[model samples]
Target chain A: MDANWIAIAASVLLQSSPLIIAVCGETLSERAGVVNLSLDGSLLLSALAGFVAAYFSSSLLLGFLAAAGVGALMALIVAFGSLALRQSQVAVGFVLTLLGDSLSAFLGQNFTRLPGPWVQRLPIPLLKDIPVLGPIFFNQDLVVYFSLVLVAVTTWWIFHTRPGLELRSAGERPEAAFARGVAVRRLRYWYAVLGGALVGIAGAAYSLDVKIGWAEGHTRGLGWIALAIVIFGGWSPLRGALGVLLFVATRSVISVVLQRSLGESSVVILNALPWLLMLGVLVVVGGRFSEQVLSRLPAALQRPFRGLLRAAPPAALGAELKEG
Target chain B: MSRPAWLPRLWPLLPSFVALLLTSLLLLAFGASPPLAFGAIWEGAFGNQDRLLTTVAFWIPLMLSSLGLLISFRAGLWNIGIEGQFILGAIGASWVALSLQLPAPLQISLQMLAAMAAGALWAGLAGVLKRWGVHEIFGGLALNNLAIILTNYLIAGPWQPPEGGSFRGTAPFHADALLPLVGATRFSVVALGLALLAFGLVVLALRNSAWGLRLKALGRNPRSALLLGVSSRRETLLAMAFCGALAGLGGAVRVLSWFDSLRQSISGGIGYLALMVVILAAFRLLWTPLVAFFFAAVLSGSVVLQLRTQLHSSLGNILTGVLVLLVLLFGNLDSLRAWWAEWRAGRRRS
Candidate 1:
């Protein structure tokens, strides 16, 4: 492959790291029957908090921790509001998102364009020397590497462990899970907060690693993209990570094509491409077209095809659970 | 155990009071005097006739958008893409204003119609997706971003002024295409009057019409409404399209009367603010305009807050968010009370 192609592949991985983390986080939350719709605002506020903490302390670790803390707090509010107050999760999340956006813009004004600490690249020794896969996967910053590990770890945790079964039961049939000795509400709160913290780490990754600066609306619109990916991923961690990669790849390709074929004016069109593509993906995935195609397959192939094409959301998702 | 009528009347206002108190504390934390900031906000919003007129100008679009959202909310749909619809409306109106050479009134009316069509078409896309099982919220959000990008492309690309590309927006519309301002203020009385007319029409339709009842029924329980012979597909499309038209009309009024050009942030987050207004009004058509006006005042006041205190104007957004959240939490006080009572009774039995 050409060096340019190799570089593009690496860049795609780098760009997708934060999104991958965020997608996993949202997938985990949604799988546990909670929807943290405050992803966008949470990202902005955490991005700001991460940048400021890193700048003041000169420690990237502290920045990531601060970002995660902020993320968890926002998630905790959504969980508390929905679980305890019996408020609509969507409403509470939406309000927090707007509030977080404005608060971040207001608070981060001073930190805009300021130099801050960033994550350093930590390439694995043996893996970095491999010909094709090495540069794309193993050679990156700590966050990028961690994001890959997160995909595998999250996939394993969600599908392989005993707690994973409990989580699924909590989301799919909360009353049944409660009868089976599960604390559905408490489990929801834990996963939502945990998922939110991961999302916060994604934000910090944007500031302290990927984009690497503090700016107003710095992480703008990314949270929404993450939310869409969670859906596209069918609320599964591995699939969600793949969805992020696909989105990032599309974005990269669009930018490259725009640079090659069009002037700066057409950049607007390029900017619209990701959203349009996501819309198309959503329509295809959620629409009847897929179902029609699935039915046309042989009966032997039909079940697997349906499984791959249709990933239904958890049955008890978004519903309030009452104690017996 | 009957509640006093006066207490019920005052109950809805509690959330606003709590939000304001909390926001005041936020101001204090920022080292600004809450009283001084609020005083400035009040003065800036309605202290003078000129400011009051400006507030009205802002209120028109907000009211229109809120009314649009009210329609969709009543139909069990969340039209989060109202911002996109609003932008498309501006684009549609701007196209008409720029391309058409008609008499002023005829041109303005045509522009509004074009805008409404554009908005309906945009929102209809989301409706179609929703009909196909795509969630309206996600579809709307994607469409919203696409619409913004489309608007930005138009303003900075083909619609770029003859002087070349600039983000300042297209050249001001022809003088004839512009709405006549009320006195020296930017406020257009005709636009305000039309908005009120729209509001009145919505109120009438929602209250007395069979269509309104069907929509309310659809929202209350889709399965039951469907069993009752309300066509979900048709009603969903109609509700979304009508809401889009209302939001489109808002965009038309905004472009023609105030800004007089297309810009990227022309919607000015009014779509989201309108959502908050609808929530605050509890979907009551009667209170939408009042809530919208209150929000507009806060927005206008925030501009003054920025000028005087060097505080960011987004403080108003923060205030709005706080207010809506508080209302969402406290709005269910009656239900919470009942739940608590039931819990205590159960505990007593145990």
Candidate 2:
């Protein structure tokens, strides 16, 4: 209820949004059985690309759009490896991370410390005026709001819509989906690209907000956290966003606490706090739930959905569109 | 399709080498001669006794850490968090070396024991999680991050030096506890050599021992291994423990040798590079040292690359990336076969 707490809470919400967006985007990727561990690299590339594009064009949309383009391109390479070449999904994911990190660093070399076009916050007047919960809920950058909408939309699509059903089917049982006339491979490609775009948007959110600065390892391990969040969410969008909220909020809390308690000597050591917690979550919950869920979860998460390999997807997912 | 008797194996390596070569082409764009740069890489690695000693010094920890990696991977487990394990090991050893004022030999032995124990504990936690249900990838990665943070906390807080200035690291290591560096090299020789000899034992154990066969069985097929009364989880814990111990040895060497001064980034990307080394060597322990030395050369020489060219340190990483990807892609010559078949068909049509 305090004024200062309100501001901090609002910032926390804003910070969490990018994580949610990245996690949701990665959800689509992993749900389709293609774990793009390259989220860190892709997010970094897009973050750099977004900042650079926004910086040059002085257009926020252009920057975010360019970020999406970069993400999709990176995703395409992963797709080329997994879908076309039938490589190990994890290996491809790993390769993409290495490639993506370097490429982002190389291309973003010019944009270091460049002033980026700040994404403006779109606060509803009445809502922004309210105290406490008002600013936290109502006032925010466009991407923060977009991320919330994306969560709802993604959940709805995956659970309610026909296309969503198809994608789910492809992810759960590609062969079954294939038998039912769904173009599983093509579906995977689009899902990965779209998912990548979302990740890119998340990266853009970082440049637009969240310390709109650039450097090597700029995005740090947000991408990997996104992957972990997806699993923590149990392949669900709403849960994924919550996980991100938890992740980013804990991160913000760590920063504040470290600032208050930890002396100068503690800074370097304290920097590892939030990440340690994230890993702790995985070791504790992520560890136990993995066996239980993996036993019942999609059998084809890592293995390619080879039509010849006879891997069956969930019923009704990716039913053939029957195009001429 | 074969060009020579040994072509299959030799051919498999060609793609990765080419990939590394092409990545160097990127250095040329930065105004460095690719061949000349490679020459520097060679010199930095093994051009002479001095260079070789330095490279070996660098090679010791890397070899120790990567052999640990190979131990896990050979059993079909991936412990990318060896970096974290390595950090924990260093801390463990540092705790013994710095905190306890025991006799020289006893201090060293206790430090080694504690270091290995700490690594085992950290990695074993991951193994427990993996067995409990989390996959190795997620569990190991999370453990890696946690270990790093914890290490940072320890080194920055209790172990922090009094006159901490620019660089944030632990206090100076006691000279007695420092791993004996052989020759005029900056790298740790005795520590690494001892570690390498242990690696030989591990290699022998993995290839010829019953435990090794069981692990291979687990890697090749979990159900079958389980059917044979081999507990995959137990094997995973044992292998992970071994891996952690090896990484811990590296960490101790790091503390005693090059980084007698503490560092947050001591393990650096060595854990990740060890992953790549495991990939390059295809899970062979002996090959780990060779491949890791090659990478260490690139890492050490990359400073020179920065001196000579406009390229970033990322070039070395990118080269390693391309190599890892290429090796995995071309493993068993699948791509080359597809390419060769296409070429032959085109030739017949012509």
Weakest 10 consecutive residues, lDDT, candidate 1 chain B? B330-339
The C-alpha lDDT values of all candidates are 0.88, 0.76
Candidate 1 residue lDDT tens string, B15-89? 888999988888887889998999999999998999999999999988899998988999999899898899889
Question: Candidate 1, after superposition: displacement of residue A307 in Å?
Answer: 2.4
After best superposition, candidate 1 residue A42: deviation in angstroms? Answer: 0.6
lDDT of 1 by residue, A1-324 (tens): 787888899989999999999899988898899999999999999999999999999988999999999999999989988887788898889888989999998888778898888888889999998998888778888888899999999899999999999999989999999998898888999999999999999999999989999888998889998988887788898988888888888888778877877775668767787788878777767848678877888999988877776767889888887856
DockQ of 2: 0.37
lDDT of 2 by residue, A1-324 (tens): 777777888887888888898888877876665666778888998999889888888888898999999888778777766665556567667767867788777766767887767878788789877777678988887877888899999999888999988878777777777799887777888888888988898898898787686888898777887877776676788877887887777767677777777575557545665556655665545434434544564678623322211222234222222211
* DockQ metric for all predictions: 0.68, 0.37
* CAPRI accuracy category, model 1: medium
- TM-score, predicted candidate 1 vs. hidden true structure: 0.96
User: Model 2 Cα displacement at A154 (Å)?
Assistant: 1.2
